[model samples]
Target chain A: MYEAALTLYGEAGWAGFSLDAVARRARVGKAGLYSRWGSKERLIVDALAAWIPPRPSGGGPGPLREELIRLATAIFDSYFDPVGLVYLRAQLEAMIYPDLFGQALERLQRERIRLGRAIVLRAVERGELPEGTSPALVLDSVSGILSNHVLSTPASQRRALLGRRDEYVEQTVDFVLSAVGYRAQGRDGLLSL
Target chain B: MYEAALTLYGEAGWAGFSLDAVARRARVGKAGLYSRWGSKERLIVDALAAWIPPRPSGGGPGPLREELIRLATAIFDSYFDPVGLVYLRAQLEAMIYPDLFGQALERLQRERIRLGRAIVLRAVERGELPEGTSPALVLDSVSGILSNHVLSTPASQRRALLGRRDEYVEQTVDFVLSAVGYRAQGRDGLLSL
Candidate 1:
């Protein structure tokens, strides 16, 4: 039922996707949906929960740079998935509405930031980042970069760039690591999955 | 007339603003707007154009890092101006509605990319950045970070951050320069600013 709701949301946006539509898509009765999820907001949130990629263990890396590249790829691919575009637009547009949709987006951003803090903390423990570096700031910057890429870059351009994900991550990691006083030129590029 | 249209667009969204409303706000007939801009789209485009801050002159600076911080602060403050948020949200939302928005957004992104390229290219000429760094890539990442700061951070947080804009820019410049094999540490931090 939740999957049906997300798919409908992805196709029609929040305004367009009616509860009846979700019932039809899910092949369930309206009463069942109402009984199970209580509201459209809960339905959407539950769908999102089911769709989110599981946290990957950042183990098996030769170096922190390599591990980071591997991690970033998973993150980007999941968030920017083509199926996720509508939800992305919905979430961004939610900022204006500031009701149900807005609350949904706020939750997502907080979760993302928390996850980002964990990543930064891991990097610090591994001695990949400089001491005294603010993980929140670094997360903010990195998240900003990736978000801009998805939101601003043309889809065609993004596809081409994704093909060269290794190169992009390599240069990015090099620049990031270098800026933070960890010279890992030897890592030099993406660590393949 | 253009000023009136910009204010309307800022108050209402692209969908909400209209030619009649613009004429009403300007206290001018609809014909006057049609004569000047030919269409609603063109009018809004010109309005955005009118709001853009002039790019910083490259002549005055100690190094690329110093100049970049100066330029960034100027750009940041300009975009954060009261009307700027409306323009930004409108522009971003337009990208999602490709057919309705036309090529205005594409042109805007290109213009932004071009400005970024100019800054980085000048830095290269001055030997502040590495020889082979792609100007486009660097600009993309830099712009990405800046865009994220604007979109994600709330206004109060932004005001707080702007108060310490010097420190933020110093940290950014310090990191970028160090990563790119330019100057290090004290040279790029707030004391120099």
Candidate 2:
């Protein structure tokens, strides 16, 4: 049912999206949807919460850079997923209906930030990052780059970028490391420092 | 007239956006709009081209970091403007009507990339960035960060960030400089490094 809702919303943005259409697509009666979710906005909020990838656990038992690379790769993969694309399209509704959409998106962003800060804090404890490095700033830099690429790039080009996901993650992680005043050490693939 | 079009489009989005509404808002007849642009899409493209800020011509006669800071600040300001909000709303239409919106957006992105590359080239020539630094990559990093912040952050928080635009630009510039293997050498305001 949630999948049906996502497909409908993705196909027709907020303006065209309708509860009736969702019911038709899901092959369920209107009463069924209404009983479960009560309102279209509530349904969307629940769908997005279920769809968003779980916050990544901290990189386990690896070098800080390696752990960061793993986390970045996971983030990039989840964002590039088809379901993630649907969530992004739905998020655009915030521009038109901030009260309806902002709550769900704000909650999601808070979780993402909290998870990102934890990763950075773990690195600091391991003596990898500088003592005063701002986790919020670092996470913003990394996530901002990924979100920009996903949202702005043309569809054809986006597919190609997704194909090179590993390289993209590595470069982004390297950029994040650099932003925090850490010179990544190694000559692997495109990053040579 | 373009401002009217932007306002209607921003308020109603692409699906609800209508030539008739634009004509009503601008207090012009349908024939006048048709004779000028021949189609709604053409008018939108023209309006955006006129509204988007001209590419910053890299701060002349200043340090490379200073030049980048200027360029970044300009890009940030343009994106947060009312007209820019309209463009961001229209961009979401691409997810639903790819063929209709994609053509205009692809052209705009190309021009933006070309201008960004020019800025990075100037910095490399002035010995600010490493010789092998990729201009496209660097521009993507800078523009991506700016776009992400504008599109994703909530309205109230976005206002707060805009209030500190200079500080934000400095940190972003510092991040980009670091990404390209250069350490910024100034400690004014928020940038402690």
Candidate 3:
């Protein structure tokens, strides 16, 4: 039922999406929907939580190079999902409507920074990255690159962009990993010696 | 006179900035200002041209590495100038108020991308970067990283961020340069590898 609401929200944006529309899509009673998620904000928040990738695994004794790519790929893939895109757009809009959106946007960015820092920190500890690199800054740069790609508009351009997302992501990951002094196996394909 | 007006606009924001304030700061007659620039918007447009950095003198020679640093530093330095900050903020607001700001921003971004592409293209020709690296993607990532720095507010926080900006810019430059297959400069001091 919640996933149905997310689909409707993603299709129509916040203004066009309706509880009845969600209920109709879900084949569930309106009363049950409200009981499960009390409001639109609540529902959207839940949907975002549902959409975020679960904590990445394969940490123990894993190859630092491969694990970093796995981490980056999982992070990149999350943006490919429809619900993730919708939540992102909604958050961007909230930035402009600060009275209503500022707190939520702040929370989201802080959470992102925190999660990103952890990933960088772990990579450093595992000898996959340099010692003094600030996890926060790398997180900011990587997130900035990925978010820039995702937020580009004019739906027609998105297909070309989608085709190129892997290249951009791979290039960006290579950039960040290299900045932290990580030596990944496959970048030679892109880096050309 | 124009620079004073731009600085006022940046400090006060659009609603708060006034022609009288500009006149006061410039120590110029309002009549002279009105005769030249016409209005606030026109004044801002003119200031944008005047305040942009004069293109550097490296010409067709020198390492692409040093030229890229100069380019990024020019941008980072401008953020400290009051008028430059105002221009940056106004452009961001104008993104949502396109009818008011018109095509100036679109044109500006295109010009910036062109400049970036020129530098990257030069690198490829020099065999300093990979053949297939998309100049457009590289430029977009550059903008994203710089814009992320600009939009990060809470003046104190932004100040703290400045301390890290050099490191951040260095990493971003390294990222782009390496992603394009630039030969790794042994012991490139910033990355601490």
> What are the RMSD figures for all models against the true structure?
6.4, 5.5, 10.1
Question: Which runs in model 3 stand beyond 4 Å of their true positions?
Answer: A1-112, A119-134, A146-193, B35-38, B49-51, B54-60, B146-168, B184-193
Model 3 lDDT tens row, A116-176: 6676667666555678767655655666566554443223344576787667677776676
Candidate 3 C-alpha error for residue A124, in Å: 7.5
Looking at candidate 1, what is the lDDT of residue B140? 46
Better of 1 and 2 by lDDT: 2
Q: Which stretches of candidate 2 lie over 4 Å from their true place?
A: A31-39, A49-51, A54-62, A78-82, A86-96, A150-156, A182-193, B20-24, B27-62, B86-97, B149-156, B183-193
Cα lDDT tens digits for candidate 1, A1-193? 7667766665445545567789998788899788887777778766765665334455774466666667656645644443455445444445444455555555555666677667666766656666676665665455555655555565335568778876765666556655555534234443332
Q: List the residue pairs that clash in candidate 1.
A: none
DockQ leader: 2
Clashing pairs in 3: none
The local lDDT score (0 to 100) that residue A13 gets in candidate 2 is 56
Candidate 3 per-residue C-alpha lDDT over B173-193 given as tens digits, one digit per residue, 9 for 90 to 100: 776666556752333423212
Model 2 DockQ class: acceptable
Model 3: lDDT to the true structure: 0.59
A185 Cα displacement, candidate 3 (Å): 14
DockQ of each: 0.24, 0.34, 0.10
Instruction: Compose the digit string of candidate 2's lDDT tens values, residues B36-122.
Output: 888888887777666554346544744657777777776677564545556555555664566776766776666666766776776
Q: The CA-based lDDT of model 2 is what?
A: 0.68
